[model samples]
Target chain A: MSHRLRILSRIRKALDAPAMPSETARAEAVAERIAHPPQHWPLRSIQTADPEGAAQLTLIGRFKAQLARLGADVIEVGSVAEIPAALANYVAANVADDAAGLARIRMGSDAFLAALPWSSTSGLEIAAGMAEAADVIGVSRAIAGVAETGTLLLVSGAENPVTLGYLPETHIVVLETGAIVASYEEAMQSMLAATGGRMPRTVNLITGASRTGDIGGKIVMGAHGPRRVAVVLWSA
Target chain B: MTARTQFDADIDTALADAPLQRALADVPAGFVAGRRRAREELLEFEPLRRVARDIRDHALAHLDLYLEAFESNATKAGSRVHWAASGDDACRIVLDICRAAGARTITKSKSMVSEEIELRERLQDAEFDVVETDLGEYLVQIRNEKPSHIIAPAIHMRAEDVADVFRRQHGHLAPDRKLDTPEEMIAEARGILRDKFLSADVGITGANFLVAESGSAIIVTNEGNADLTMSLPKVHVILTSIDKVVPTFSDAWPLLRLLARSATGQAFTAYTTIVTGPRRPDDPDGPEQCHIILLDNGRTELLASEMRPVLRCIRCGACMNHCPVYCSIGGHAYNSVYPGPIGAALSPALAGAEQAAHLAEASTFCGRCEQVCPVEIPLVSVMRQWRSLALEQPRSRRARVMLHTWARLAQHPRIYRWCAGIAARSLKWLAGSGARIRRLPFLHAWTDYRDLAAPQGGTFQQQWAQREHKRAQRDRADVSAARARKSDSVP
Candidate 1:
């Protein structure tokens, strides 16, 4: 056969793959707070929380390993109170008397609450009130895999703002080991089933950074959003 | 500063530039390296090329479907879609939009379609401040020049040349400044453009891929200017050819794969922002109004011709980057906005054969463009087609007569041989002793670098035939001996 014919045949095959499941089922699978995707809500909760203390320590170690692989500069603070100190030291060392860098960081991060001069009780509400707060706040969603691209899906509930995934540069995703899904199609099916085929108001499946090559064929990363991507995978 | 539309004379002048020749010479070495790197890194590179080719072919086949889908989707998303059947129509549409928006200052990203329609002149005629945002484009724009290389608009410019231009243009602003380095120059441009980005009323950009499925126009850029251009401006206008539209995102993926690698050997663009529509009500930053001008401009007509394969071009500039002729003359030598191999084919299609006749003659027909074309556009063939078209014009009476005289004389072998013999004798006599002529009126360009070697006493064809006659006698003797041996053996 000719080269064109052979290529057309391959495309036909890719398009003709059997329908896996309903879109609702895939969406539900993606939205669930499992360690991975596809386990029932009750069963996933069991895996997300260690039955004993043994698995909890093991999962913490795994989270640290993933962080190292992602090449993020890690700082382990004892509590939320110490987070301000950690961030200040980071800002001082990296950025030297630059308001622009400070502004960028403030715009990028979701957890910029403790450092601001708000009253002790006011906390995150003040950071959220900032005009140019992060573009998206990413939350961890246990989805199978993306149906089209192999993107990690995150759904927003009441605690998790939808903007976390899209707005913020630093995606402080608290992912448990049980939340990994196989494919996007399967994740979509689960998501659909859980939501009764009604997709979220804002669903973000992030693969990489916000990039464009519009200027003289040069690809500049982080145009509107955070150029820096930091993922915080932790035990449930 | 303005670029001339009458490119024929300007191109002839640029064809003589020395620095342009130097720049062209460097094209092959870098292009080979970049393409090889991309191929090695992306295992799916070839597959993506095939997929992209198929997608483009499919789209071209069913273009009406996708065009309708794109129009409706863009319209539904609150973007006004305008149809332009010609380059003039496209320019008129953009000018009308600018006039209506009260756009005194317009910042434009690199759009080949805009260049195709000579948009800057049109906009300037209407008295609008049009600034080119792309660095290479900015350099070319400031100098009142057209792009020489499609990808690197200022590829032919030397650092010293650029420094001089900058000094002349920006000396008053930083009169005491001593600028020497490229970094300094870049910083200066960045500082100047920072205010331009914010103050612009309208932004015009080019689309890499127009996704019909979601009514999104994808612009791939390395600089953050596109985002600023789109977000800061009240009115965002996209000038794109009809061929840019694709069926869906799935189809877009393969083309994107080939485009980056073929253009600059990047795995992916730094920013591949997909603008779906005008900013939503709650959205903080984005254009209030979006308009996508779908410029046909003889593309549909080209699609109906033998040169239809030329539309498969993703504008990667690989062909130009790899082209020997393009490297030497630079883009200005071609005199048309689109230069290099793809330009050689396309300019004639968009512009009339009469206007762009000289462009087709710019190519060496070396087939480098075709070899490096990711979508496999038969660039050389298209160029040859243009050559034939030019030849058949019937207007060039002198040229036609000359060709006719040569053709009529060339038919009779005896006459042609006699003419060749006389010409050879004269040429041999002209060379004092060494087979070199320092200067000859008609042959000056040909003999500039190297001398034409004198032919032997006889033509190769005649010499070969004589040798064969002698060899046939020897062969006959051998055949007789072999036949005698065979007869003895049979007995």
Candidate 2:
């Protein structure tokens, strides 16, 4: 017998319970689970535990605090036009070493970010493609943000490739205050709404810059991914 | 290391190794304290644990349905799912994939199932250059050792040990180069792994959760190695077992919430990527071919057994992180691919209780493992079941005689009390001066490790009876006084 058949038969024999659910039935079961989740007590507890529950300013405050806590630099901008100045100012202040000479930037090809006024930025050559070794900065517009954990939910496609989130030395995330949600559940719901209830190829939920505590239980950031994650919170 | 079957000898070896003892100290100071602090931060930590446990149990109850759902959705997403009946089968499938990809170099993130199958050894034996990207796993790989802990693979090694390993193995580097600090070591490793990541043909990672709702595989990592592993390679193969599938994204939240808090006490891991399948046609990057090997190596039988509750394990390493015995002797002593409380319960289930049954007896029965377990696995109870199975095996004459004597004495209370009184008095007399007893008759196994507390007085039954006599006298006096008061009131 084939491996799949043999394994399935063994599972069946061992269970001795009943036949497994059919394919369409599996989808139906998922729909039912989502609609009437049996385990909502924890979610309820989370809701009751929160003091400033989903108040817009409170949610944005929590998101910014979490982002900073994860070692990501945050700057609230009044408009999308201010993003270039934010990027330029961050480069000017943080770029101390002259070892790399001029720093190049990589941004996602997503239309939302592509429409940004990048021509207003001076001295920084921004490229729209996958990050290269020389690309010191990466700016990608997060589709959504989780206020509970300060995580950016970036969907992978031709427009917003996932590597831009992990590659480059510094990642500058562009997220609007309205995009920030209260919890992962809210984050998932918004993504479902955006995708028309279809799943993306890859959903990257990056909380902080890369870090590792593997050696002697000591944490060292900038392990393999970007050394730093900067958030441009366009609040207006 | 001795053979994996010699768990007793392995324990003795681990106990004597001063370096391993020192290394084991970090776990309690790091993972234990971090989890405690993280729990304090969450007001509903305990309730969340209940939620996580129920989520896992519900997932396991409908595992067959979820697995089928995952297979169908994953297939529809342009990924191939293969079934492996055993470890060898899984290895064969991987090797075949490498051959198909013409892969010379393989980059891997931390995967315990891959360790269980000894994937590295199998790959190297087939002449594939394999690199473990996780710093801890990489250190263990170069040192020719298995992971001592599930999450922190090289927790057994000190910084100095890693420095020595890098010096010896990284032969291409200048001999005089500084390799002292963990920072320096990380830099060196990062530089070395960067080239390998770019050049590797296949990237293999383990799924923390397989979302059946969207046919996505969830992998949470701190160092972003899994990200690079999947991102850089042309082909990505997920090495996961049959039990990892959850019904949907919502069902996976509670587990994810507890996972980081329980593992390293982080609010969230640095990276939590959900890959549905291979990259889309319009995607700028990601593997071209994505294959998921769902290995059912003894898991189906486990799922079908009374021990099915253990299938809810999320491999968070929380059980071992808080295990006192594990903190003392470390993970290598268990002699199975897994180690610690869950290891004691799970090894037997996966490797047959008959051969690996010794693992269950390695615990102190402290119940800390169960208390800290996010999935709320009754680890102590599972260990007891394994002990019962082990007892059914043939035992030495001394063990059989001792057990029989204890059972007989326990059955006859009068005789047991008489013998216990004499024994207690004698032990008290032996104790004599000071408090502790260096030598004892029945507790040789214990005194070898720590000083045994000498008996203070009579047997527990004798003390209880004396207390009862005093209580009875007090009761009679109270009743007489109440009767006198009643007569006075009547007059």
Candidate 3:
């Protein structure tokens, strides 16, 4: 028998010895659970205690607060048109003035971000492609934002390469106000709906800038990924 | 002098190592305190733990079905799934994949499964350049040591020790570079590893959870090294076990909720990436090939045995963090891929009860591990089971005789109380003035480190019976006095 068959048979025999439900019954139970996965209790912090719009506002507020606590900068802009200026301002404030030259912001070919008025902003060069080793900053559009943990859900595709989030020294994500949700389950639901129940090649739920406590038990930021994560939350 | 066991020597060495002692001292304030704060902030932490435990239990109860589902869905999603009956088989499979990819350099993130199989050394023997990417793991790799703690691999090292390792290994760099702080050291390592990430041909990681519904492998990391490890390489290989497979993403949510909080005291790690398969045809960048290797080295036997609940472990390292024995001797003393309470319960199952008997004996059975475990595994009971299993094996005549005497005495309460009372009186006589016995006959191994407290002059049953008799006499006297007072009032 193949290793697969041998392993499965061993598992079957083990369950059988324990007098557990029959294999057929177990399989049906598994199938039923998968078809209708039970919903767990939502976090009390994100429970809806007001109207929809107010609840959304509360979510965005909670999301910003949580991210701030994790050392990520959250910039609120009036609309998409103001994002370039916000990005430019963030670059000016966070990027160190180095002798090597102008700060270049690498991004993917996401239409939502590419269609933005980036030409209006000066003093920064914009490159649209996969991230490179020399890229100091990379911008991507989050598919959704989870308020429960202040996480950004980014799916990998042509529109948003996965490297853009990890390669750059600084990561600036653009999240629309409407894309913020209350919890991971809701964020996953939105993702499944967007992909017609198919998962993307990669889904990143990033909560904060890269950190590590491996050295002397001290948490030092910017270990292997972005040192700083700046989110431009724009009202669409 | 009585001959000391290897386990005793290992503990003595660990306790005497000043640097290790200092490092272990920080764990309570670090991981332990951090978990406390995280738990305080979440009002529903207990409920989430219950749900998480149920999810793991349910998944394990029907693991065969989920494994089949995961295999089918992953195959459909362009991922090749391999089943390995043992660690050697898994390593052979990985070697074949590397050979097929024509890989020279391989970059790895922190995977306890890889450590269990000792993958890096095997790859190095095959003449492949393997680099560990996680900061803590990198430190361990460079020092030619195993990870002391699961999450914090370099938890045993100090900053000065790390700098010393860097200086010796990184000879090409300036000999007198200032590497005083963790910041400077981290920056230096990051600069060196970035090249490895970009140039690696294969990336191997461990899965924190495997979603059978979507056929995705979820890996959580604070440094995002695992992300870059899987994303930058052409071939991404996930080395995980069959127990990691869960039913759905929803099933994973509660586990995720409990993981970071239990492990590092964070609401979430910096990055939690769910990789379904290889890169899509239209994707700009990702691994072109993805392979998931499911390992079952003695786990099938464990599942069949009475210790099936051990499979529900999520490798969060919470049990170890709260374990007193683990805190003292550390992971290296256990001399296994896993250590602490969970390791004590599990190493016996994996390595067998005979060879790993010392691990089960290392615990104090404080029940702290079970209290802190997110999955609520009965770790102490499991350890007790291993102890019994170990006893059932062949043993010395002295040990067998001692155990037989203990069993016989424990069955007869009268004789047991009489023997205990005599022993207690003897100990008290030995103590004389001081309340502690500085030296003990035939038990010098225990008393060598610390003095033992002398027992009181009576057995526990004798003392309790005397106290109860006095209370009964006082109650009767009070009742008679109350009756006399009532008669006088009636007249």
Best by DockQ: 3
User: By TM-score, is 1 or 2 better?
Assistant: 2
Off by over 4 Å in 2: A17-31, A34-39, A44-57, A96-101, B1-5, B438-444, B466-491
What tier of docking accuracy does candidate 1 attain?
incorrect
Q: Rank the candidates by DockQ, best first.
A: 3, 2, 1
* Candidate 1 vs candidate 3, TM-score winner: 3
The global C-alpha lDDT for each of the candidates, from Candidate 1 onward, is: 0.62, 0.84, 0.88
Worst 10 residues of 2 chain B by lDDT: B1-10
Residue range B1-491, candidate 1, lDDT tens digits: 11223554455566677766665565565555777676665545555566667667766655555666677777777888887767787888888999999899999888888888999889998889998877778888888888877767777776667777888887657676856755556656665765687689999999888877657788876554565576677999999988888776556656765776788765445445566677665554557899898877767667767787888888999888887666656777676778888887998778877767557777778887787788888888898888888775654566668898899878988888888778777777777586666665586866764467765666666778789999999999999999999999995
lDDT of 1 by residue, A74-139 (tens): 455555455444444544453333343332332212232323333332212223322233233332
For candidate 2, lDDT tens digit of each residue in B51-126?
Answer: 7777787677666667777888999998899999899999999999999999999999999999989899999999
> Is 1 or 3 the stronger prediction by DockQ?
3
Score candidate 3 by TM-score against the native: 0.94
Which pairs in model 2 have colliding backbones?
none
